[model samples]
Target chain A: MSQAPSDIDDLIDLMARLPGLGPRSARRAVLRLIQKRGKLMQPLAQAMQGVADTARECLQCGNIGSDDLCKICASEKRANGEICVVEDVADLWAMERAGVFGGRYHVLGGTLSALDAIGPEDLRIPALVRRVTEEGINEVILALNATVDGQTTAHYIADELAERCAVTSLAQGVPIGGELDYLDDGTITAALKARKGF
Target chain B: MSQAPSDIDDLIDLMARLPGLGPRSARRAVLRLIQKRGKLMQPLAQAMQGVADTARECLQCGNIGSDDLCKICASEKRANGEICVVEDVADLWAMERAGVFGGRYHVLGGTLSALDAIGPEDLRIPALVRRVTEEGINEVILALNATVDGQTTAHYIADELAERCAVTSLAQGVPIGGELDYLDDGTITAALKARKGF
Candidate 1:
């Protein structure tokens, strides 16, 4: 027929709903899958099934993993008495890729948003609190984004854990290899304010 | 323990191999799939399985379909003598989306490229030649891309099918609604040279 199969069209529709993909990109992706069914599509399908069958949010930190408790939560090496808190799993993954932190993480699920009506109970704040007390955490590092809602959530967490343990946020400054001219006014101001001895 | 599972890593690596997707995008896509495994990832995996189980290239036209003879090849309505030749299935899908072509299509798979060592034999050119005569084709329309290799392949096919049927190529000019300032010199020149009386 002149039109594509309804299933293929449905697949494209679902693909377009992904984070960075639009309808045009989804169409191209479907075509690529069709063309590479044996080499790529089949394998991709199998992998998705594998992940879908096993992937679950960590019971302790809200991180995605195959088990109820993620690898980080289960590992004794990552138990450094310091927990980096992020607003989402993507940020957790980004921190993991950075390979700097030897400690574990706690995902907040999302930032506090008055407009979206997200409250403390909706996130994993209580679990984080319990973890801080039980694990004898020395510090809670707020790795949330610098947006208003992110900061609001971070400040709320800091307030909640202030009496229990030391709390700190990531430093605001010019990024590594960042050009001064390209930096926004807010970033420049933040960097200037947070400046320390070289 | 901190890193993602090998299966997920494999999925991300395979996703990166798709056209238009890089490593970073693939990572984002994989994470999104993990987060939405029940809603998006499961359905996507099922769709892929459905396509993989049934999808096969049309023996006659090289179009991807769920059947031995694609819907177009099987349909009596699409048996019109006009065969629109394209470089790939993506072009076929694009033309289909436009809903202009009512006849059948011949997907060449790829263009004739000497540097890449791609020849007529590598494409479906021989099959196209056979279809032109056997299917009682009245015209062979070359709708290949405007690129050099596409033109070369079109000309080659035209020369081969010249004695069999009426050979024609798609008209080249400034695209409809395309701004004059944005068009390249070659397109403008061709549009000017091909100008007809009002």
Candidate 2:
């Protein structure tokens, strides 16, 4: 049967493929956009187009920015000789939002996977190794996830940079807002094992 | 603090205002888009722009379309002396997806809300009445929502068009795939009240 004239329906289909939006949610969003076309939808469309046209991956790091080199990589004051290597740009943005880490970041794009045939060459591991020596980094913090692939990638990076610089990792423990009762078995064990002075 | 380089952060903020997305989800979605610029992001941006530029509400009915008259409104085959009334374009799209109603639709944009200062003039109720006589509509089916405001709007329309045409509404019963055990009290009562012969 014929439907909402291809263009609108196509937009709905694409919106449904977004991270948190399902078919029902996407339809509602599209309708909302249509209703507020001048105020919301048009501006959203323009912003997306602007971002799509300008956004690019940093040559030095994998962080997304409007230029060839991201702001973190371009800034001279941020060269604090500490590099936080992350698995995704989302993690880098998360780190930036926390406002704790003062040094620069190196995004690996994704972790190495045997099932997916993604190796060190597939990720930014080689670029990271080169950056360690070129930038005179003192410490390389592996801010990867706790997943099997994430750990494997972290370990691989640590091994690769064993001779060049001191390698470190994020402290494995209960999250800041986590309760011991709700904490997973592994996290509880790690938090207890790594307990510090009161 | 200068968070996320302005442009990216702005996009995230705008995306956060969408129907089903929050700030965190919008951030994740933006990162996802930035990561896959070529495959997903660019296409989505283009689609949004396309729909934004083309989509307009049908002047007669409130249905969204690229032109003044929507396909359903323009089509002669769908002029089956019936006009289905809905609260939003999303509801219209949902009805289209179901492919059950073989007639045109009238989108009221929103239900009557006294608290919000919404009234008959605020909705498409007057336009619906005009269509009943102009289009020789034998039936005006009220496919409004099940909410109080929706029901209030339905009853108001039914009262307005009592002499003009047959005012009908969607049957309230247990949905096709719905289980009685999981049904809410109101739905159960409605289903029992509207029970038909076996």
Candidate 3:
């Protein structure tokens, strides 16, 4: 087998650099792209170009969008005075997918990690505090991950905004569809402590 | 949570349509792309566009290339009178990656599948015969898959080209690093029957 065409090889190399794709899967994907050049390939290229050109962080909320203010931040309907704070845009997207929260979001970019030397200034924590006061926020929901750093950041933000608004964290428990047999000791303990009347 | 921007959603939707990616992974991939716009996303988009504009099927062997004749078909050094036959361009790429066989290829595009109503005429069997007789081929290596349809196609091709040149197939046995305890009955039986003097 001779070297694949440079253009196709380049495409495969770049695609392999994506989050989940490896070399073999990238080759498969490139073949699939070549096979469907008229439909999937062209459209995907255009979409990537579009996003690369226009996508930006929401200055107010740190959510990704094409404008300075993300749609969530721009919308009056979403300014329900209740801001759900998250660790990353991916987490914010996950929350949106659940579609349970009626309020807007604040993306902190990352947690406070003293080991990594990441302080509050490194994240969007200052911006979050400013938004709480300026926007007259009534509640700040910490939807950060359950990691130690995540909890630490949540606690730090809670202390900073304790006087300004109500501070709450997502309920800790066993996940939906999770089995007790598979649950870790910490999760089991937390779920037991947070048990409610059925 | 508010609705995500349309462009970002479109990118995620297109990314999800690729093989081995689903909605969740697609979102993660898109976010990563957005984060690394200059380093990865833009280059990927350009590569996609380039491949889409230039990539085509090698008219001679059904392999993918930027020209009518794939590099393998055009290269004189690879004309070793041995043609490896495979079911798809993916299989052809797999053989190339192995870098063992020093010959050209004949991509059948797919196997002879009666259930799917595919036949010899539907595939490149006639093309293979033409290549063998016209190109003065000495051997035809049937490197098709181990599926029922793949074997059936291989036999059909052998019957078609037996009088013209020698015909052979890839050996059937346990794959490399395969554990005997995990081996299926069919693979174990085939490997036992094809045992060599090791």
Best by DockQ: 3
- What clash pairs does model 3 have? A101-B1
Which of the two candidates, 1 or 2, achieves a greater DockQ against the reference?
Answer: 2
TM-score of predicted structure 3? 0.94
Question: For residues B125-183, could you state the per-residue lDDT of candidate 3 as single tens digits?
Answer: 99999999999999999998998888889889999988999999999999999899998
Model 3 chain B: ten consecutive residues of lowest lDDT: B1-10
| Per-residue lDDT of model 1, residues B106-130, tens digit only | 9999999999999888998999999
Second chain TM-score per prediction?
0.96, 0.96, 0.93
- What docking tier does model 1 reach? medium
Q: Which ranges in model 1 have alpha carbons more than 4 Å from their true place?
A: none
Full ranking by DockQ: 3, 2, 1
* Alpha-carbon runs more than 4 Å astray in model 3: A176-179, B174-182
Q: Which digits, one per residue and each the tens of the lDDT, describe model 1 over residues A1-198?
A: 325777787888887877778888888888898888898999988988988898889999998888889989999999999999998887898899889999999999998889999999899899899999999999999999989999999999999999999999999999999999999999999999988999
C-alpha positional error of residue A196 in candidate 3 after TM-score superposition, expressed in Å: 3.6
